[model samples]
Target: MTVITGPLAKQERDDTGALLQSTLVDLLDLSLLAKQAHWNVYGPRFRAVHLQLDEVVTTARDYADQVAERAAALGVSPDGRAGTVAENSGLPAFVSGWVDDGKVVEAIVQVFSTLITRMRARIDEAGRSDAVTQDLFLSLAAALEKQSWMFQAENRA
Candidate 1:
């Protein structure tokens, strides 16, 4: 089988590929979590929180595509399969059944907080080997941070 290759050294490629693959799993699972929350969220703020969930889903999906493509470009296969995401993702699962808006907002804030921390570490790791991958992580981090801030705002009095 022919393997795709990039400019980074073997070790660099391996490191960056691992980072991309991990981030891909996180993004895919996050999008699924947001969609679940979007569909089942209720309560007085339901409309606003439901709409916001869609935004998060969009952001996560967009970044997932970029991360996967980045991995492929580096000759690494990105495994975003459901089993992979379920097995590899460190993010917590959303509660089953109807969730109140307050709970959804609180849960998302926690999830984003965790993800942002990991994304920062990814940015640092990728920076050591590939600026190209690091740049993608940076943009994704910015978008996630913005969404996180929005979610945080929802929980505030």
Candidate 2:
């Protein structure tokens, strides 16, 4: 078990730091997955899909930076290396090959589902820590759920 020895207690800030650290790994994985889809996606909607996927990766990178800096503030070591990210991420292993548009969306949906699940789990962990972490997680959880809902909505339409 990782023991925190800093002056800060295991309250909202620590919980927030942990969540951010964990989320960073997933965001990095998402960025890479988006890139993979961008490169190999084919059939109809190739250009649009590829461009959009590229855009998501770009956005995710910025999110990763924020999470990494937050994690650092709490004096926790970040699993920022590619190998560490692969090991830490909750997203399933990516299946290689040219993915059809629907399959691409489905795969991304699965990844998002896992991400939302992990985020909720971290929120629970924050509860054990205290109110501040809980509130921070509440905010992030809401945002993540909204994003997940949008992804699910796209697939349903």
Candidate 3:
């Protein structure tokens, strides 16, 4: 909780920043998991799943940046180091090996689902302290839900 001389009170900013930091950690972990899937996914839809995984990685990275930037704007130092993300992120650990396209989709969907659930909780948490931070979480949650839909579709017949 650094000095934040903004419209929001110091306590409000600190609370919002904490919520954003949690989201950032999850986003960072999710980005890495997406890249892992992109590198090792194989099967009949290899090319398609591989490219889609890259899109997921890009989205996660973008969201992570947004959340981190918001925290910094409030004078809070964002902890986005790989070790911090690894240890603090709530996302489940991804299996490390070449996975079939369907399995990769399943894994991605599961991750996205978990992220969306957490984001929804963060949205409510932020709303109690800052509307702007709540809006940010809302936007991120929408994008994550869309990504989840795409991943789930790939698992369909």
Please give, for residues 67-122, the per-residue lDDT of candidate 3 as tens digits.
99898887788999988987899997889999989888888888988888999989
- Candidate 2 lDDT, tens digit per residue, 72-140? 656666678988887888788667988887677678778778877887887788677655545655665
Which lDDT values do the candidates have, in the order given?
A: 0.94, 0.71, 0.89
Residue 142, model 2: Cα distance from true site in angstroms: 4.6
Clashing pairs in 3: none
Task: Tell me the TM-score of model 3.
Answer: 0.95
TM-score per prediction, in order, is 0.97, 0.76, 0.95
| Candidate 1's TM-score | 0.97
Best by lDDT: 1
Judging by TM-score, tell me the better candidate of 2 and 3.
3
lDDT comparing candidate 3 with the true structure: 0.89
- In model 1, the runs with Cα more than 4 Å from the true position are none
Error of 1 at 85 (Å): 0.2
Relative to the true structure, candidate 2 reaches a TM of 0.76
On residues 1-157, what C-alpha lDDT tens digit does candidate 1 reach at each position?
Answer: 3289888898999999999999999999999999999999999999999999999999999999999999999889899999999999989888999998999999999999999999999999999999999999999999999999999999954
Better of 2 and 3 by lDDT: 3
